[model samples]
Target: MDFSIISENLHYYFDGLLITVQLTGISLLLGLIFAIPLAVLRTSRNFILTMPIRFFVYVFRGTPLIVQMFIIYYGLGQFDFVKFGFGVFQEGFNPDNIGNQTFLWKYFFSEAYFCALFAFTLNTCAYTIEIIRGAIESTPFGEVEAAKSVGMSRTMMLRRIILPSSLRRAFPAYGNEVIFMLHGSALASVITLMDITGAAGIINARYYAPYEAYITAGVFYLCITFTIVWLFKKIEKRIYAHLAPYVDKTQKTAAVN
Candidate 1:
C-alpha cells in the first residue's frame, strides 16, 4: 500500500537495524565469555562454588526480559545514588555548573542504552550457562575414563579435552541461542533505544500505516534470521563434519541433476 512512506524512511530503518545488530552482537559476545567459566564452575560438586552461579542463572532465566530491562532502566533512577550521578550532584543540580570529576554512574544505570545492554547481557548469559553446562555434563563416560587412565588432572582434562569437545557439541544449541537473543533485542525499543522495532513503531505512529511499517520491519527481521540460519548451518556442518555420512560426489551430482 504505502510504499512511498517506507521509501522515504528507509534510512531510519537501516539505522535501527544497525542498532539491533550492535545490541545483539555485543550482548552475545559478553554472555558467551562470562558463561564459559561459570558453566564449568556450575558442574562442580561443591555447593559453595555452584550455588551462587545457580541462583544467578535461576533469577535471570526465571524473570521476563522486559522486567529486567525495566528494573535496570527505570528502577535504578529511583535510587538516590544513581539519581544524583554517584554523588556528583544533588536535587535541582545545574548542568552548567557540573563538577570536573569523572562520574561512573553516567555510563551505566544513568543511560538507557547501557542499561538495556546490561540487561540483555545478563539475561543471555544465564541461558548460555545452562546450554554449555548441559553439553559438559553429557560428555561420554568412556572419554572421562580414558582421561583418568592417562593421569589427566581435572584442570588439564578440561583444558585439553572437555572444554573443546563440549564447545563443539554446544555449537548447534548456541546458534539457536544467538537467534533467540536477536529476537529478544526487540525489547530494547521499550527502553527508548531505537532498535528495528522502535523504528517501525515510530513510522506506524507518524504515517498511520501499521501494515507497511510493521511488515517492513518483519522483512528486515526475516532477512536477519535467514542470514543467521545460513551462517550457523555452515558452521554446524564444519563442527560435525566427522559425523556426517560420506557420500560419493558422483551420486550427489546425479541427485542434484
Candidate 2:
C-alpha cells in the first residue's frame, strides 16, 4: 500500500536482485563442472564406482533443500572439530594469540551466501548427474560398436563420439535445470542472504507493505526465468541444428532420373 517506501528503496532491491543472479550463476557453473564426472561414474560397470555415486545422488535428492542448507550452516557450526579443525593447528598456524579468532570464521565462511551456495551446488549436482547419466546411456549401442570396429580406444570413442552426441540429446533437460536453479536461488534467503526475496522481506517489515515488496521480488524472479529460457533456446537451436532433416535435392534428382 505504501508506494513511497518501495520507491525510496529501489536501489536496495536492485542490489539484492544482482546478488541473487550472481549466486545462481556461480552455483550452476560450479555444480555442472562437478556433476559431469559423477554422472560418468554413475554409468560405470564397476560396482565400486557405481554404488557410491548412486548413494550420493539418492541422499541429496531425497532430502529437502532447506534441511540441507540448515545442516551445512547451523549444524556444522555446532561441532568444535568442524569449527576449529586439526588443519587450523598445522605446523605454521597458531590461533592461541589471535584476538577474536572464532569471530572471523563465523562471520565470513558461515555467512548465508556461502552456505546457500554449498547446499544448492550439491543439490544441483545430484539432479544433473541423473540427467547426464540418462543421456550418456541413451547413446546408441551400434554407434559405440562401430567406433570399436574402427579400432577406436574407449577414451577416443567417448571423446570423439559419445560425449558430443549425449550433450546434444541432453540439452533440453539441462536447459530446464538452468531455469529451475534460477527459481530455486530464492531459497538462499532462508539462510539470511540478502537476495531478492530476503531484501523484499526486509523492506516489507520496515514499511508494512508486504504486497509491494513481494510483488517486486516476484517480478525480478520472472525476469530471470524468462532470460534463462531465451538463452537456452538460442543454445538449443545452435546445438541441435545438425540433427534436423536435410532435403538432399541432388540425391532426389538422381534417383528420379
Candidate 3:
C-alpha cells in the first residue's frame, strides 16, 4: 500500500541483502573447509577418532540452531573463563566499563557478526560432514579395489579415485546445503546483525509498516535463492557433463556396414 516507503528504503534493503550474502558466504566457506576433515574422521576405522566426530555431529544436528546460537552468544558470555579465552575480556576485566569503550574495542569479541558466523559455520559443518561422509562411503568399493589391483597406494587411490568421484556425487547435496545456509543467514539478524531480516525489522519499527518491509526482505531472499539455484545448476552440469551419453551416428553406420 505504501509504495513510497519501499522506494525510500530500497538502499537500506540492499545493504541488508549484502550483509546477508556476506554472512552466508563466510559461514559456508568456513563450514566446508572444516567439514572435509570431520567427514574423514567420521569414516575412519579408528574408534577413538570416529566416536568424537559422531558425537559432535549428533549434538550439533540434534539441537535447534537457534538454541546453539544463543548458547554461543549469550551463554558463553556468562562464563568468565570463556569470555577471557575468547578475548571478550582483558585481564582483570570488569563489566562496568563495557559501555565506555570505543565501538570497535567493545565489539572486537562480542560482535553479532562474529557470533553469527561462528554459530552458522559450526552448524553447517556438522551437516556437511554427514553429507560428505555419506558421499565418501557411497564411493563404489569396486573402483577402489580396481585401483588397488593396479598397485595404487591407499593415499593414491583416495586422492585419485575416491575424492573425485565422491565430489561429483556430493555436489547436489552440497548445493542444497549452500541454499540452506543462505536462507539460514536470516537468523543473524536476531543477534542484532543488520542483515536483510534485521533491516526489515528496524524499518518496520520506524515506519510502522511491517508488511512492506518484510515483503521487500522476502523478495530479496527469493532473488538470492534463485541465483544460488541457477549457479549451482551450472556447476552441476559442468561437473557431470561426462556422464551424459553422446549418440554417435558414425558408430551406428559402421556397425550396419
Candidate models: Cα lDDT each? 0.90, 0.84, 0.85
Q: TM-score for every candidate vs. truth?
A: 0.90, 0.87, 0.88
Model 3 spans > 4 angstroms off:
85-108, 247-257
Best by lDDT: 1
Q: State the lDDT of candidate 3 residue by residue for 1-257, as single tens digits.
A: 79698898788888898899988998899999999878977888999989989998999899988899998888866765454344445566665655544443356447777888889999999999999999999999899889999999988887899888997899999999998888888888888889899989988999999999899999999999999999998988899889877767769977676
Q: Which residue runs does candidate 1 get wrong by more than 4 Å?
A: 85-102, 247-257
Question: Which consecutive 10 residues in model 3 have the weakest lDDT in total?
Answer: 80-89
Question: Global lDDT for candidate 2?
Answer: 0.84
* Model with the higher TM-score, candidate 1 or 3: 1
Q: Model 3, 116: alpha-carbon shift in Å?
A: 0.4
Better of 1 and 3 by lDDT: 1
